[model samples]
Structure formats: structure tokens, C-alpha cells
Target: MARIAVIGAGTGAMAAAARLAVAGHRVTVYERSGTYGGSLGRYARDGFVFDTGPSLLHLPAVYRDLFVKTGKEPLERCVTLTQVDPASRHLFADGTAVSLPDASRAGVVAALDQALGEGAGTRWAQFLDRAGTAWDRSRRPLLEEPLRDDREVAARDPYPAPRRRRLLRPARQAATLAQIGAWELADPRLAALLDGYALSYGLDPRRAPAAAALLPYMEQTFGSWYVSGGMRELAGALYERCVLRRVEFVFGAEVVRVAEKDGRAAGVELADGTHADADHVVLGAQPGPELVPSQAWDATGTRSAGRAAAPGRFVVMLSLRGAREAGAVHRTVVHCEDGTGEQEAVFGGRIADVPTVTVSRPDDPSTRPDEAHEAVTLTATVAPHGPVDWTDPALRERFADVLTGRAALAVPGLRERILRAEVRTPAETAADTGAAGGSVPAPALAGAGGAFLRPGNRTALPGLYLAGGWSHPGGGPAHAGMSGALVAGLVVEGDGFRGSR
Candidate 1:
């Protein structure tokens, strides 16, 4: 049996550890923090609980497969998963509001038509049909399998843009989401609906490939789900599953560097000047410059390619005095009025004055001390750590106010109802999760000369692999879990392992 050492307790690393252990390998995980979940962080104060990481989970099938493969208990037995109907409520700049039903194209289209105008439903339905084509074309190469050397297949945009020609003008197809929104949808409100999806992931619609439409398609097709407690509960279940399989974990054990032997990864060195030897190593953290010897990681594909800058989230956690009323939506998105200005500000190293805000209010009573209390979370995409001085108390409060003010659009009297408030910035996120510059990696997209493609799971260094949001398939809980599966498959089945069966 190979002795496998996994660095960091991130979702992907833990997922790989569980599977490898179940496959008869002796696995040990070393995490720098006292907790197991990395970015799946949780905050609690005065009996109020908040999920600082992803509020909702999409594509839960990834985790379901992880549980089934690792143990006899299915995912449902470990955590209660519920589909959130009216998946999300959208507030447009034109003062139109619509709540889209979960995973129902007909319902979403009808809602759009009712809120936006006539013909809106038909146009959106047609667009989704086309988006399905992109989903089919890219799902396998992008999510199901490890990235290969031939970038042509994945690099080529899978989105089938319609060809349109004006009088005396040549026919053209859209390359970006913004272009598709303008040329295809041809409605500013519809354009905002599409752009909201991109901006939510910290991506600029003007540059993100049209293939990005797959994001909405994936959500609407598979459906959005929420755990009984919070996302932390899901992480806890995964951690418990790993422990049940005899996977050893050492928390608060910071890895100083990757130990090397005969030009291969031997194991890891701890910050306390200790070492653990292993035959294979899996990295879950972004390969910082000090992570491994410079020569070791110099030419490795495991190293991040330093892609274009992505925005980080500014979160405001509110503990309200009132009880959450019945029939409260799980998520609400307040879109910006000036989409261009918002995009330019965030992507140009500044936070927008009028940024889009997503407010999450789950009806679970466990999140609060009593039925008379409520827990609300507001998130807005902002410039990453370095670009923004989130450390400044005044600046942080100003941004928190902005988020709360915008969220008030969905939840009336939200500011006055707040009994207490807690703000989390990218700087705190970086400290908690170890993301470089506190920049959350955007979900992978197709285009920009394969710029959006994450580095391959296998690196130039022998016996070393990467598994996490920072690795192959890119960010999001689902993608991170998929990366773990791919890494385990490669380590056990060798380079021939494409993906799980």
C-alpha cells in the first residue's frame, strides 16, 4: 500500500484522502488550521450562525458519489439535502422583480415574461435550448475528466452563438456573454439577468466567454440545494466519512515545505521542523512561492499559471431581532443599474459604488437561538485583498453599509432589524482559507487561449498532484470535489486514469 500524504484539509484534499483510504492506501492529512473545512468556514456568535463560504450547493452529485465510493452510507444519510424552490429571486434595475422556480425552464421563462414583458419567455427558452448544447459539448472535458495536453477541444468555445447579419453587414457570432446578451437577448433586463450570473462568480461578462452560459444551465438543469444546518454541516459529514475510513488527520499542523528525495516528492515538512514520509503527495492549497523548493515547482504544471485577477467577496452577517417569516426565499440577487460601471470598477482594481448583492435567508431554526431570531448574510463581489484596504475599520464599515443598504431592497427594514452585525472581508478570507491575495478563483470557463483552464492535476514533479479549487476544473465546491476524484483516480490507476467510472 502506498503511503499518501495530503496537504490542507480543504474539501478536495479531504475528499481525495477518503477515497484513497477506501482504496486500501494508507492516507494522512495535515491541515494548518484547527478545523477540517478550509474555505467552507462557519461563524457563530450569540447563538447566531452563518456560513461564510458558499451559502448554497449546486451539483451535489459530486459529493454523493464521494460518499457512496468511500462508505456504505449514502450522502442523504449523512446530511439532509433539500431542493430550494423558487431557486432565486432577482431584482432588476428597472424595478421588476421575479422569483424563478428551481430547475423548471417553463416556470423560469413564464416568470420572466410576467415580470419583463411579452416574448421574453420565448426568447429565454430558446437561449436555454442553445445553452444546453454548450453544456453537452463541454461537461465531459471540463468537469468529468482531468485536463489533457491537447487544449484544442476544451479551449474551443462550446457555446453555439447564432449567426446574425444586418443590411450590408457581415454575419457574426458572439464571443463574450455581454455580446450575446446584447445581440441575442436584445433586452437590457435580459442582459442584466445573464450578466448577474457572471458577476456573481466574480467574472466580468464583457470578457467571460459565451460558453459561460453553461453556469445557469447547470444550475437550472440539476437544481440548487441547501443543507439542513449550513454548508459547514456538509463539510463536517465529509470529515466524518474520512475518519470512518481510518484516514488520519493532524489539525493545526502547518506544512512548511514539500520534502523531496531523488527528485521526487518524499513527503512534507512541518513548520515545527518535523517530517512525514510518503510515496505520493497531494496539494490542496495554492502553490505559494514558499510551498516547495523553487527548483521543485519551477516547471511544474501544478503551479498556478497566475491567471487574470478575479474579485473577492465582502460579506456582512446580520443577526436580526425578528423571526424569519414563512415563505421566505432562500436567495435574492439585487442587480446593479450600471452594469458597465460595476464591471469596470471591480475588474479594474476598485470596488463599485453600486455593486450587486446576494442576500441569503434560510428558514432553518437551528441557525438561530429561537424562532424570534433570524440570521441573514449579504455578499458582494469586490476587489481582492491587496487592491482594497479592508483592514481599515471605517472603510470596512462603509462597504458593509453598502451591502446592507442594497440587501434592504429585498428584505425591508433590514438595517433597523439588525440586532448585531459582523463583517468579513477578503483579508479575513485570506487568513482563514489561505487564498492568495484573498482572491476567490472564479469558476472555469472556455476561451481566452485556454486562459480559463486550470493547470493539469499531474505536475512535472514525480509523485505529486494537485486537488482543490486552485487546481484542475477550477473553483466551486462541486469542482473541488471533482478534482479530488480525479487526483485519486490518477494516483491509483496511473496516468491512464481519465476520470471516475
Candidate 2:
């Protein structure tokens, strides 16, 4: 059996380990953080629990597949499912409003019909139906593949070959989500839906992908659910599965570097300066010095030729006295009637306090005390380098000021209900997790080669591979899980969950 050393205990790393171990490889995982569950992981305050990242659970099957493929059943381990609300209420710049739902695309169309009127409903249906189809089409092939084969991806283009030929660069226009967003012209409604799509990326909808306009279809169409006891439970469950499968997890162990011999990964070096051998090394995140051993950050394929998304974040860990009806509790973005207008203001360098707000309620069993408790996270995209003049004191004051304002606008008396609050800045976020520029999630900007420059799963380094939010198929908790599994399949040379036999 080949041996492998998977770095980082995030979902991607965890999933990769499972697949590698089950494939008969002697796998050892090295986590940079003291705890596991990179993004979806959680921490507790005096009797309160806070999920560090991703609150809602979509694409449950991604988690299910990891266990099943590794000879385990996720359903036997975690919460089966709980659906969240489908209606995502949007308050537009022109006072236009609509709510998109999962059960009935009809409701969404109806709302659009009311807002846009007449033929709008038909267009709405046509859009989501195509979106649903897009989701179905990309699920297995793109999500599961290591993305080493770009030619294969191009073949799946929805536009027929002749139409593609007529368009000189049809692939460029639709190869990846970000490219779609950047290429969009001045169509306001499509822009709003695109903005809604980029919400996953914490990006402005105008620059978001038109293809991404399809993401909402899952929650609104498939129904989102809570994992019951925080999505971190998914991590804990995976850890347990690793134990059951005999996959070794070296926790609280920071890998100092990866070792390579004659161009192949020999193993990894720990912070303690100890060496561990492996037959293969799977590296992820916007290729960093630590990710590629024996190579400079700029020299390795994972690093030099990689495409990194933004890593900016604004977050609060609060103990809710009680969560209000709070919409469907799945995925929500409550707006200030002028929400999209407010978002435009933000991008242009103005804070609307509560132009829009999103909250994730984890199913942590002990999240609430005798009173029902839920975890709420509120964030908006900010300048990645952060406000130039946002001094420590100024930023601190601004954060509190912003939170207070957002709470009032989003939920009545929301500021009053907080039992505790912990705020983090971009620099602080990097300090907590060694993310680049506090870039917990990297920017998915398509490089100058149109869309062709976006890094594939395969890097120039022969023995190394990449995964996580920085890797292709990008972002969201579930996407990370699948990314990890994709690397495992490639490293071990398995047939992969993608492609027909």
C-alpha cells in the first residue's frame, strides 16, 4: 500500500484522509491548528457554543459519499436531514422585493411576477429550471473530479458545439463561476441574482458568475438542513470514521514542512522538526510555502501557478437569548428594503449598517441553555487589505458600531439579546487560523487568461495536490469536503466519483 501525508484537518483534509486510508494507503494527517474541523469547527465560551465557520448544511450527499465510499454510512452516524426555508427575501435598490423558495419555484416566480410582472414569471421558471439542470450536470463531474483535465470540462458545455464555435470563447464565458460573474454586462436583475449567487463567495453580485445564479436552487429547491449539534459534528463524525477505518490523525501537530525526494513527496516535517515518511503528499489552499516542502512558495505549482480567492471576513460569535422566528432558519439574507442598494453602497465604500444580513443557526445540542440557543454570524465583504485608515481603536469602535447598527436593522432588539460577543478582523482572523491575510476563504478571481488561468486540481509538482476553498470547485462547507475527496482519488489513482465508465 502507498503511504500518504495529508496536511490540515479541515473538511478537505479530513475527507482526503478517509479516501486515501480506505484505498489501502498508510495515511497520516497533520493539522496546523490545535483542533480539527478547520472552517466548520467550533469553540465554546462560558456555557455557549460558536461555530467558527459555515452554518448551513447543503449537499448532504457530499458527506454521505465520503463514508459510504470508505465503507461506512453517514446516515448511521449524523442527523439524517432538516430542511431550511426556501424563500430568500430580497429588497432591491428600486424598492423591488422577492423571495425565492425551495419547495415551489412557483412562489419565486410568483414573487418575481409581482415584482417584474407578466412574462417575468416565465423567465424566472426558465432560469431556475436551467439552474437546476446546471446543478445536476455539474454535481458529479466538476465537484468530484480533481480538475486535472480541463478538456473534459469543456466537453460538458451546455451550449452546443456550433454555438460554441460561433462564440470564439464559450468556455471562457462559462468554464468557472467567477468568470461568469466578471463577464456579465449591465443587466441589473441578472446582476442581482448574480450578486445573490456570489453571496457564497462574499462577493458583490455584479462581479459574480451568471452560472452561479444557479446556486440558490439547491436550498430553495432541495431544502437546506441542520446537522443537529453544529456542522462541526460532521467533522467529529469524520474523525470517528477515520478512527474506525484505522486512519491516523496527528492532531495538534503543525507540519513545519513537507519532505520530497527526487521530485516526489517523501513525507512531512513537523514544527518539532521531526520527519514522517509518506508515499504521496496532498497539499491544498492557495499554494503556500508550508504547503510545498523543498520548494519556495513561488516555485511550486500549487503556489506559483495557483489561483487564490479572497480571504477577507467579518464575523461575530454571539450567544442568542432566543432566535426570533428568523425566517426559515436555513439560509437567509434579510435586507433593509434597500438591501441591494445598500450592498452597492458597501462596494463603493460605505457601510449601510444593515443593508443586508445573514445568520447561520447551528444545531448544536447544547447551543442553547434552558432557553433555546442559536449561533448567529453576520458579515459583509470588505477591502481585503482592509480600510487603509482603520486603526486598531477606530476599527474596534467601528466593528461594535457596525454590529449594533446591523442588529437593529436586521432583527428588532437583536443587539440586546446577545449574551456574549467576540469580533475578529482580517489580521486577527489570520492570527487565529494561519490563513493568508486573514483570508479564511481566498478570492476566486479568474486570472488574465480569461478563465483558462484558474488553477486545476493538478499542480506542476508531481507528488503534490491541492484542495480546500482555495482549490478549484471552490467554497462552501460541502464543496470543501468534495475537494478533499477529489485529491484523494487523484493521489491514489482511483477511478473517481466523476465521469462515466
Candidate 3:
């Protein structure tokens, strides 16, 4: 059996650890924090609970497969996974609101038509149909398999943009996500909706490739899910599954370096100056300068391609005294009135005067202190750590106020209902999760000179692989799980392993 040392006890690393253990590998996980979940963090105060990390789970099959492959119990048995009906409620800039039914293309189309204009629903449906082609075309190379050095195959835009013909205007295809939104969706609200999907993941629609349409397609097709408790419960289940598979975990043990021998990864050096030998190493977090001899930043440098900066999140956790009313959508997205300006501000190293906000209010009783109280979390995509100082309390409060005010549109009397409130900035996120400058990792996009393609799982150094949101296939909880699977498949099956079937 090969010995494996995994860095970071995050969901992805733990997922790989569990699978590797099941495959007869002696796996040991080292985490800098006392907890198992990395970005899946939780905050509790006065009997109220909130997930500081991602609030929802999309494409839950990623975890379902992990649970099934590692043990006899299905994912449902380990964690209660429920489809969030009316997947989301959107409050547009024009004050038009629509609640889309979960996993129902017809329902979504109908709802959009009912809320928007006559052809809004049809336009959205057509867009989704085209998006399906992008998903099918790129799913294998971009998501299902390890990234290849020759990105020519993956870099080629797969989004089938319809040819536009006009008098004296050459027929052409839409390349960027912004182009697709403007050319196909037509309606300003619909364009904002499309951009919102991309922006929510820290991607800028202005430059993100048309393949970015896959984000909404995946959600609309697979459906969004929520656990009985906060998303932290899902992380707990992964940790438990790894334990059941006999994987050893050492919490609060920070890995300081990846010791190399004979030009291959040999083991890990911990913060305490101790070392553990292993045949292979899997990095779940972006490695620091000490971990490798390379520069502090990867080949892409510390930031994303172009002048655009990495996006961060500004969160507001509210504890309300009132019980959640019946038939309330679990999630609501309040789109920014100035979508373009907001993107420019955030990416240009300034606070958005008006930022798109996502408000999550899960009805599950576990998050509240009985039915009398409710837990609400508000998230806004913002600029990552850099020239902007998220550490300034006044600045953070102002951003939080803007997001809270925007969320007020979704939840009536939201400001009045709040019994208490707490704020989480990218600065805290960076400190808690080992991500540089609290910059949340975005999903890999398809264009702009392969800007979206992340570093490959297999590094130049032998016996070392990467498995996390920052690696190939990119971010999001589901993608993180896929990274783990790919890493395990590569380690166990060798060079021939394309991916799991």
C-alpha cells in the first residue's frame, strides 16, 4: 500500500483521504486548524448558528458518489439532503421579482415569463438549451478529468453562440459571457441575471468565457440542495466517512514544507519541526513558498489574468427573533442596480457602491433556537485582499450596511427583524481559511487566453498532486470533491486514469 500525506483537512482533502484509504492506501491528513472542514466554517452565538463558508450545495451527486464509493451507506443516510424548492427568488434591479422552481426547466421558464415580459421565459429557455451544449462539450475535459498541459483542446470555446446577421454587420458568435447576455437574453434584467450567476462565483462576466453559461446550466439541471443543518454538516459527514475508512487525521498540525527526495515528493514537514514520510502528497490548499521551491505565487501570479483582481466575500450574519414564515424561498438574490459599475469597482480595487447580494434563510430548525428565532446570512461578492482594506472596521461596516440594505428588499422589514448582527470580511476569511488575502477561489472559466484553466493536479514534481477548489476543474464544493476523486484516481490508477466513470 502506498503511503499518502494530505495537506489541509478541508472537504476536498478529506474526500481524497477517504477514497484513498478505501483503496488500501495508508492516508494521514494534517490540518492547521482544530477542525476538519477548511472553508466550511461555522459560527455560533446565543444558540444561533450560521455557516460562515458556502451556504448551499449545488450538484450534490459529487458528495453522494463519495459517500457511496467509500461506504455502504448512501449520502442520504449520512446527511439529510433536500432539494430546495423554488430554488431561488430573484429581486431584479427593475424591482421585478421571480421565484424559480427547483430542477424544473418548464417551471423556471413559466415563472420568468409570468414575472418578466411575454418572451422572457422563452428567451431564458433558449439560452439554457444552448448552455446545455456548452456543458456537454466541456464537462469531460474541464471537469471530469485531470487538466492537460496542452489546453488547446480545453481552451477552445465550446459555447455555441448563434450567428447574428444584420445589414452591413458581419455575422459573428458571442465569445464572452457578457456578449451572450447582451446578444441572446436581450432584456436588461435577464442580462443581469446571467451576470449574477457568474459574479456569484467571483467571476467577471465581462471577460469570463461563454462556457461560463455552464454555471447556471449545472444549477438549473442538477438542482440546488441544502443539508438539514448548515453546510458544515456536510463537511462533518465527509470527515466521519474518512474516519470510518481508517484514515488518520492530525488536527492543529500545520504543514510547513513538502520534503522532496530523489526529485520527488517524499513527505511533509510540520510546523512543530517534525516530519512524516509518505510515497505521495496531495495539496488541498494553495501551497505557500515554504511548501515548494517555486515562487510564492503560481505561474498565474497572485492574481487572476488581466487587470481583474480575485474576488472576495463580505458576509453579514443576522440572528432574528421572528420565525421564518411558511413558503419563503430558502435563498434570494438581490441584483445590483449598477451591475457593470459594481463589477468594475470590485475588480478595480474599490468597494462597489451597490453590490449584488445573496441572502440565505434556511428553514431548517437546526440553525435556529427553536421556531421562534431564525438565522440569516448575507453574502456579497467583493474585491480580494490588496489595495482595498477590508480590515478597516468602518469600511467593512459600510459594505455590510449596503448588503443588508439590499437584502431588505427581499425580506420585508428585514432591518427591523434583526435581533443581532455579525460581520465577516475577506480578511477574517483569509486568516481562518488558508487562502491568500481571503480571496475566494472561483470556478474555472473557458476563455481569455485560458485564464480560467487552473494549475494541473499533477505538478512537475513526481508523487505530488493537487486536490481542491484552487486546482483543476476549479472551485465550488462539488468541484472540490471532483478534484479529490481525480487526485485519487490519478494516484491509484496511474497515468492511464482519465477519470472516474
Best by TM-score: 1
lDDT of each: 0.88, 0.60, 0.87
Q: What is the descending lDDT order?
A: 1, 3, 2
The digit string of per-residue lDDT tens for model 1 on 369-486 reads 9999999999988888887777999999888998898999999778789999999989998887778668887777776667677777787778889899888888889999999999
Question: Cα deviation of 415 in candidate 3 (Å)?
Answer: 1.5
Residue 18 in candidate 1, Cα distance off native in Å: 0.6
RMSD of each: 1.4, 5.1, 1.8
**Model 3 poorest 10 in a row by lDDT:** 295-304
* TM-scores, all models, native as reference: 0.97, 0.80, 0.97
Which of 1 and 2 is ahead in lDDT? 1
For model 1 the local lDDT of residue 490 reads 93
Highest-lDDT candidate: 1
Please list the residue runs of candidate 1 whose C-alpha ends up more than 4 Å from where it truly belongs after superposition.
293-304
Model 3 C-alpha RMSD vs. true structure (Å) is 1.8
Model 2 regions lying over 4 Å from their true place:
91-98, 114-120, 132-141, 149-193, 293-311, 322-330, 335-355, 361-365, 372-375, 385-393, 442-454, 494-501
What is the per-residue lDDT of model 2 for residues 1-501, given as tens digits with 9 covering 90 to 100?
Answer: 887887877777778788788888888778776677777757677667666666667777777777888874655455545565553555444556566655676776777777766656665566567666666665554565546454354234431111123355544344443334334322355445545546545655544434454466566676566766677777788877777778787777877677878876788888898898887777644566655653433433433344333535566666777754544333445434443565565455444455455555444456656346555666555433353222366765676557556544445567778777776555565655576555555323332222421345555556677777667566677777777777876776643535223
- The runs of at least 3 residues in candidate 3 whose Cα sits more than 4 Å from the true structure, single-residue gaps closed, are 295-309
Residue 359 in candidate 3, Cα distance off native in Å:
0.9
- Cα lDDT over the full model 3: 0.87
